[model samples]
Target: MASYGGVAVSGGMPRFSDTLINGGVILEPWAGIRAYASYAEGYTVPDVGRIARAVGTAGVDIDDYVNIEPIVSNNREIGVELKRGPLDASAAYFWSTSKNGSLLVQTAIGAPFEIQRQRVEIEGLELNLSVKTPLPGLTLSTGYAHLIGRTDGSANGIDVVDRDLDGANISPDRLNIAASYVQGSLSARIQTQFFLSRQFERTPNAYPALYRFDGYDTTDISLRYQTGFGALSLSAQNIFDSFYIDYYSQTVRPNDNAHYFAGRGRNFTLSWDYRF
Candidate 1:
């Protein structure tokens, strides 16, 4: 390790210190109905691995490659919530803007990756609902999210190729449904999640083609029992052994032609928790 005046090299382990503020207001104008609005600022630093593996110009020292700016974003949202008897629901719309956004862009299908410095805009809608059945200790819940993201077509005030931001590790649409039951000390729950099709990678300098990921879903179930001494639980994930790919595995690399990594198959787990 190298150092400068008691500071270790590698930019002192790439430290990032940021301050964020978020606030919201909820108004219950009448019984069982409420509305809210929120504003928040988000900040994120680049991954150290992204820096280490970044494709750099020849003759540049590794230490010099670690210097990169962080991404900062501001989010604004407004929503309404309802809680009437056995029904609970909420819906919201949000928009976000980011400057100096970090995106992975490859020159070709199997080429190395480089960061794209640009502005980004993301807008989305979210809806959630949950209802408790008249039946003893049973409830059903469902949720959906739709996202539309895009990037500014300018770099340094010059027009460049603009593209959708739906991919790049983010799916444009998502859905989830779950049902749960509770009686005495026993509880059971089951859930399924769906991911809508999304762009996989931004491939430029090649044929103008659409690169996307197919939609997929997975189901999981769990049961738990509480005892005097401990708790016992059992779980089955991807119950049907659905074949899929990891969300972030579409990056272009030389050895692989941007083939995605497979998702986990069916698996079962059991465990006990002891309380002291």
Candidate 2:
């Protein structure tokens, strides 16, 4: 096992600082069962260019811009897995907190510039399971994730509100599922996704602050063929060509007719790969 920590400084800026520590232990108190755990912590300062972009103003002299304090994030995660015969499963949880988190604040002119005083917190849990059945050449795998986010000292001090909706954007819940079948040199896969109902902030002057959207569902399919020399693959996205809007923001001006940017329709791609 090995662990390390160090610090250094260069240029006219402050010295760099970081600390990392990790160790793993394998336990086999019984046959066919295993357990392990590891932990780590690290830190780093922000980039000079990012700092400049966050505080610099348009049409102003670069020399006039001032440097803001560097931001930092602390992250942690832990996971465990179990396996027995053809079945295997694992679960993990992660969380992160930022001091002076960086974010982009939209200007009155409709462009997003950077801001650093904001703070952010994110937490999530994930699980994965897979099984191989007695049936010859058959396998099944599935996974899911749940995430939550919050911001502190926002423009309106509203916690748990969708920051993406600040400009009248809407955030929706998402679900995804996929499966694949394999035989010989050919394989096929199919996937589907669903988005729950969302409400967008309309052009403040023309309509109310919110516009509800009907949820939409979409599916995709793909097939691939492998030869001795190369492999050919093709896929179609949004195969159902379901018409829906992925994102929308309130226009700066209420009377502006072009307030929404439409989402894409059905799309396709094909490619071939060869190895020497």
Candidate 3:
């Protein structure tokens, strides 16, 4: 990816390019068990002058601007799966670390700029399970993930937490479940996701607090008819059109006065596909 654009807040011109390569391998050493691992590397150009100028406007004082260096990261993960009869389960652990990490730092003046001197580390675990029963048209699937991140190096004469240390904006834990049923040409499915409240550190004296939002549950039903000319189907999303905030950002004042991004209300679609 390459971008040639000027900073909106600052008048400085910015340019960047990145190349990424990722690959993985899988091996089966025994019955009902398989293992896999993968790695990826990324190289990118940095615009240090643009970043410095932005940060300077944010109330930081710097005598000179320095060009940023390329950023790099290394990631590795291993996992195994087990299958038996009508049930299957899998789990994996992953760790990733980055050097010369590029991040936008905000200064007291509220100016934000990119910096490539920072380092970051992240680790996570994931688990998935699926079961199919003999009972006609019955299938269930569920999964969970937990992630933690932190800075690998010190910054601004303070020990910053590796993960969004300045704020509580990290998506740490997630749970999801999905089930589907089919009878002849008719099918129905229900899926729901739950995200734990996120914690943010508002002040040095005060501990982080979790902001809560109602969990999400959505159901979709669809029917398709087979025809000589084509096939037509209809579907609906968010059938209930639950009223809730999908996302939000905090304000300087510790109040919930932040604007909320609304989720999709009730929506329907009809699709047709034909083969010549």
Candidate 4:
């Protein structure tokens, strides 16, 4: 992949271009198992929309635009899957490194926006399991993932832990379990997702670890029925009414109390579907 763009400045328009390559492979030599491995290289440019909004605003600097650089990354992963009888399982490990990775940084204290560059290293593991019970049309599935990331170099004058790290915004651990049943024209499913606690910066200017959002889980259920005319469906989201803060809301703070965007409470929806 490749991209080209320019920023208007007093001197001239600074232009940039980036290229990326990606590929992967898989092998299945046994009836119940398969193995796979993959590698990829990619890059990203700054968000021009956000930059446009900041232009001419107080405390915003044109140098912010000049400092922006394309972020590049190299990633690799390997994993295996197992399938036997009514049971299936899989696991994988992945590692990635980013060059000039862009992160929210405080150009100065209380700055609303700033982008810093760093070399970042990230690694993680993922797992999944599923089983189909003898019970007619019933299945259970579960999955989990854990990740960790840190700055890769020391030239930026900040310790890996002091950079208001962006990775901290991501929940390091997550789990999801679900059950489904299907018979005739009727189907139903229920699921729950758990998020492990993570650290976050209240503002792009603050140390990334200044605050934390306690982990929380939410549940949802759905049911559907089909008739000669059309299908009817009902869904209950956040069935448990559990509350949580998503990643984005935690990263930026207009005020101390406003840092979190509360998770939605329980809600319901019903709908009809027809095909011509």
Best by lDDT: 1
Alpha carbon lDDT at 101, candidate 1:
70
Off by over 4 Å in 3: 1-27, 38-68, 104-117, 152-154, 157-172, 183-185, 201-227, 248-259
What TM-score does each of the candidates earn?
0.77, 0.67, 0.67, 0.77
Off by over 4 Å in 4: 1-8, 11-19, 49-66, 106-111, 152-164, 167-169, 199-210, 244-255
C-alpha positional error of residue 220 in candidate 2 after TM-score superposition, expressed in Å:
2.0
Q: Model 1, residue 76: what's the lDDT? A: 96
Report lDDT (Cα) of residue 110, candidate 1. 55
Question: lDDT per prediction?
Answer: 0.73, 0.57, 0.62, 0.71
Question: Going through the candidates in order, what is the number of backbone clashes in each?
Answer: 0, 0, 6, 1
For candidate 1, lDDT tens digit of each residue in 59-134? 4444444336578899999999999999999999999888667676654555555566677778899999999999
RMSD of each: 5.5, 9.4, 6.3, 6.1
- The residue-by-residue lDDT of candidate 3 on 1-276, one tens digit each, is 012233333333444567777999999898888999999886665665555444423333332233354667888899999897888999999987766665544343332334535666678999999898787777898999987666633455554543443333235477888887776655666777666445543334444454333345455555666567787878787777776555333322233343335567889989998978
Ranking the candidates on lDDT from highest down gives 1, 4, 3, 2
- Predicted structure 1: lDDT: 0.73
TM-score of 3: 0.67
TM-score of 2: 0.67
Residue 30 CA displacement from its true place in model 3, Å: 2.1
Q: Tell how far residue 141 is off in model 3, in angstroms.
A: 0.7
C-alpha positional error of residue 39 in candidate 3 after TM-score superposition, expressed in Å: 4.7
